[model samples]
Target chain A: MTQNPQITPEWIAVDCSATQMRATAMGAAGPLAQATGETSKDLEAALLCLIAPWLSAQTTPVIACGWDAAPFRAVPCMPADAATLVDIPTEDARISLRIAPGLSQTNPADMMCGEETVIAGALALNPDFDGVICLPGLHSRWVHVSAKEVVSFQTFLTGELFSLLSQPDDTLDGFDPTAFEAALSETLSRPEKLGAKLFSLRAEVALMGLSPRAARSGLVGLLIGTELAAAKPYWLGQPIILIGAPGQCDHYAHALRQQGITPATLDAGDCALAGLSKLRGLL
Target chain B: MTQNPQITPEWIAVDCSATQMRATAMGAAGPLAQATGETSKDLEAALLCLIAPWLSAQTTPVIACGWDAAPFRAVPCMPADAATLVDIPTEDARISLRIAPGLSQTNPADMMCGEETVIAGALALNPDFDGVICLPGLHSRWVHVSAKEVVSFQTFLTGELFSLLSQPDDTLDGFDPTAFEAALSETLSRPEKLGAKLFSLRAEVALMGLSPRAARSGLVGLLIGTELAAAKPYWLGQPIILIGAPGQCDHYAHALRQQGITPATLDAGDCALAGLSKLRGLL
Candidate 1:
């Protein structure tokens, strides 16, 4: 019997947000080891704790992306052709850390902190893929990429609203697809009715004893339906790709399919690591 | 100058919600004395405390309108024409308490616990006033009262959403009317973009250092603009009445005036009392 030897990573990539931070060890092929932790008051200490095992005596390049970057501290106006990186001077000389700059738009006055990396990675994967990319998360971003340059983008607070509305440990039991589709369709056609429709969840529960799964699906459908209507111009006749966790992407894919559009899915973590990889080349 | 003599009332009108309870002493003309208190575990005790000075030896009728009633416990299905009142069956023999029933709709599965009293009061003010009545509160209600009957109504979680988004004790300092009108117009035209427009409030604050007053007005404008878009059917070409606290009603009126509608304003507490006064006549 024989055992294959282990391979070491060339660098490390970390994506930190207000709520969570994820670190991935990058190898030549892809991600090797990954760690995640809840964002704490001391994020740097938390990041070091998660990636300590991967840190070595040698000065290894570690690229970080998310809210910690300079671009994210304020409203950043990065041009479509802008590819800038900000180095985070670390206390330990052995660890070389740099953060990727996020993208911002002026007209709508919108900004994105973390999802820019995923868009970068998606763009890297398909250099010629010029279309709209949907990244679902706490603050979902719908980005428009053309000619290998990131153009304007919009951010939707769909995931944040859902989290605020649902219980911490809430989980869907037996999701009803019919309910979800119906809500999605109705909301898409009449997005303005959202302010009134949201409370119906409580009404249904109080009156008909709506199941947890049905309620969960209904909430998600309403949020996504409203998002789709706003982002209609972006996905009207463009190739669309969704990047997020499997569950999040599944919901988005289902909603888009209901609108007669088929979108390809990409792993969020991999895209983040891949985006950091692309930024590594620029650095 | 001679002082007007104090007048005693025959009955008391109370409006109780999940958060607070308001009581009004009804004289022959209108409300004479008003009292309010935060809702506690013992609601009946709280109600007694609020109206203790007004309690008389006689079985003074206390007409209550709020979540304390049976229909509010769960999803109530009271028809538009169903103006039923339930007795509170108080332990106090000197108190005769009865609660006004709320209105519920079936198609959209909507229900209101406290605002029905305001609608009833508005109808009582003008029996032939066949138009829409906008009740602004935590769950703002847009009610249709045709021929003194509640044909249908809708509820928007505008106030609730604003509370969740704002900090506690947050006050708008020097509210910018121009900014609010601009946002209201923009959102009314593009209501679906609300999900995206909301996050920009945070971005503008971070990037541009937006004033709290402007930000507050923007949030209010976005919410009310969306509500107006949904309730357009109710207020368009109709004689509208705004029923709520002065501050809330002012905002509704300002928004309506932007659309060239001058809605008559009515004090919510007085209207609740007046509604109870009308119900007392029937009893």
Candidate 2:
């Protein structure tokens, strides 16, 4: 059957975080182009600048997601479950802008914006996949997916804390896997000591003159350790799928391997595109 | 017991933190004058300006403590146990500045500068007392004191974390004891979940429209709960004394009371003065 030109897959998927924005242009088979820019004071203007080259004469559907997206429409706690898409009014007539609603958990009162689309894509790819999917980023998500639905999830501030602590002059220079493992074990055994443990990093550097790499690795280990300890219910003996930037996924993968669990990894950008494509197919 | 005129009543006690400096003029009876200033680019100049009026024609001994104090001289782990005082050389002939050394633990590798003097003063006042002294500040310390010595100590970044999280625009309004208590209980029960629990604060505010007061109290509760869980070894069955600013002390007191403990409190400034006075007697 001949396809309708209007619905032949001219679309753009945008993830706009508080600081940065990424857009992927989708053609018939796959992504045509990918662009990123700072999410400036005017998000639309910045987003237009990034995806301007990908625009066509046809009305191209723009699906945006992230914390910076307009107020989220509460969706059911299920993976790959599409929520009502709200239209984002734009000055450009060629653009049909719409934002995907985020996921929310009422009991713990947790929420995820951009990751929901990624989760949708993952679930769509593996319909029978079960267990936890960890999306590591500024706000890391540890989501429980059972029978292709997101039952519940938790968000950790591990990435944000690490970024804040290592900003400007506090950058850690070296990488020490041993130090990271040791710190991970320490935190896992005594998670309550995390508050004191965090400060000890600074003291160690100041007094003991600890190597920058050791400090950095130890910090990552401590944060990930605490997260694992808390997310034990979600990952203990269960398969975990790691999704995020390659560097972050590698860090998580290493951390998990140290704990005797080897998690599967996926690229976050690819996942976002796949998720958006899957959603478009549903539409 | 005739007093030597040269060594008579003139003395200054200064506490120099990373951001600010406070000085008190000590007379025969009590503190005669108090001054404070920003810890500027030139610490010596800033310190001089703070205590210039209190300086005597005869070189007045200025006992200094805090993070800005000279590198600490290692001392025995005993309450009120003195360390070698390091003289801070200055251009001014009138200033005879000597900095008190802070306590350091080798095992966990922790250090404290100004709080050591307060612990000293606390020990001086209660020679027979032996217990945990909680000094709450930017870097809160839970020090175990036994037999007039600082046996060991742990430092928590609770205050610092709270300050950082509440800055710019996220200041929590009002006070909610119930919320604080609830959060404390949650964190104490599952301290490992703290990393995830922290981000939930922001999410709750965004998704659930949680009150600022509740959020503030919850943050305090979560931090203190985790601290209390780790510090159980120090304060579980032991008598506790708090030395810090009244507000911080009160918060610690309330948090402790929730755990079925009534802690005695001493003013940190007064403790510093008393500790310096006791040290002066030794000199």
- Number of the top candidate by lDDT? 2
Clashing pairs in 1: none
Off by over 4 Å in 2: A1-9, A67-76, A81-83, A170-173, B1-9, B67-75, B78-83, B170-173
Poorest 10 consecutive residues of model 1 chain A by lDDT? A73-82
Residue B32's lDDT within candidate 1 is 79
**Residue A123 in model 1: lDDT:** 77
Instruction: DockQ each candidate and list the results.
Output: 0.66, 0.72
Local lDDT at A37 for model 1 = 86
C-alpha local distance difference test of each model? 0.78, 0.80
lDDT of 1 by residue, A203-277 (tens): 777667777788788888888899999999988888999998888889899999887899999998777777778
Name the 10 consecutive residues with the lowest summed lDDT in model 1 chain B.
B73-82
Give per-residue lDDT, candidate 1, residue A251. 89
RMSD of each: 4.5, 4.5
**Candidate 2 residue-wise lDDT at B225:** 85
